[model samples]
Target: MATINPVKFIQQVRAEVSKVVWPTRREVLLTTVMVFIMAALAAAFFAVVDLLIRTGLSGIYGIFG
Candidate 1:
């Protein structure tokens, strides 16, 4: 079994955290807006596809019933 020293682990964690390049506020906001736009577009596309499928199924039932 490998043993981990708590003090050494904490020092390594802090070092790694300091090396991280955090995203700027502008970049975060732009990406958030893009995600919302993509989500809305995806929802709209799925709604249209559902409507088309429903219409097709209804037509099929009407023809057979």
Candidate 2:
């Protein structure tokens, strides 16, 4: 294996980092909001499904037990 010099490695790392396209603040905010919205929607969907299943099981037990 070849070992890299620390100074050269730092320079290469900075050069590559400079080429990155960082997101704008507005873009970041929009994506963050969308993620929260989707998470809330997913949580709500699962809550409804769980309630339905629980209600169904309760009904079945009421009849048999």
Candidate 3:
């Protein structure tokens, strides 16, 4: 295996970092909004399913109580 020189290694790392494509502020805002919207929809869906299951189990338990 080849060993890296400290200064050259740092330069290479900086070069690679400079090549990265970063999102703009507007793009980040749009993506964040979409994520929240999807999360809210998923939460609503699970809440309905959970309510149905709880109601069903309560009825089953009441039969023996």
The lDDT per prediction is: 0.99, 0.99, 0.98
**Residues 7-58 of candidate 3: C-alpha lDDT, one tens digit per residue:** 9999999999999999999999999999999999999999999999999999
Inter-residue clash pairs, candidate 1: none
- Model 2, residue 48: what's the lDDT? 100
Give one digit per residue, the lDDT tens place, for model 2 in 23-52: 999999999999999999999999999999
Score residue 19 of candidate 1 by CA lDDT: 100
Tell me the TM-score of each prediction against the true structure. 0.91, 0.94, 0.82
Any runs in candidate 1 off by more than 4 Å, and if so which? none
Of models 1 and 3, which has the larger TM-score?
1
Off by over 4 Å in 2: none
- Candidate 1 residues 12-62, lDDT tens each? 999999999999999999999999999999999999999999999999999
- Per candidate, the number of residue pairs that clash is 0, 0, 0
Order of all candidates by lDDT, from best down to worst?
1, 2, 3
What is the model-wide C-alpha lDDT for candidate 1? 0.99
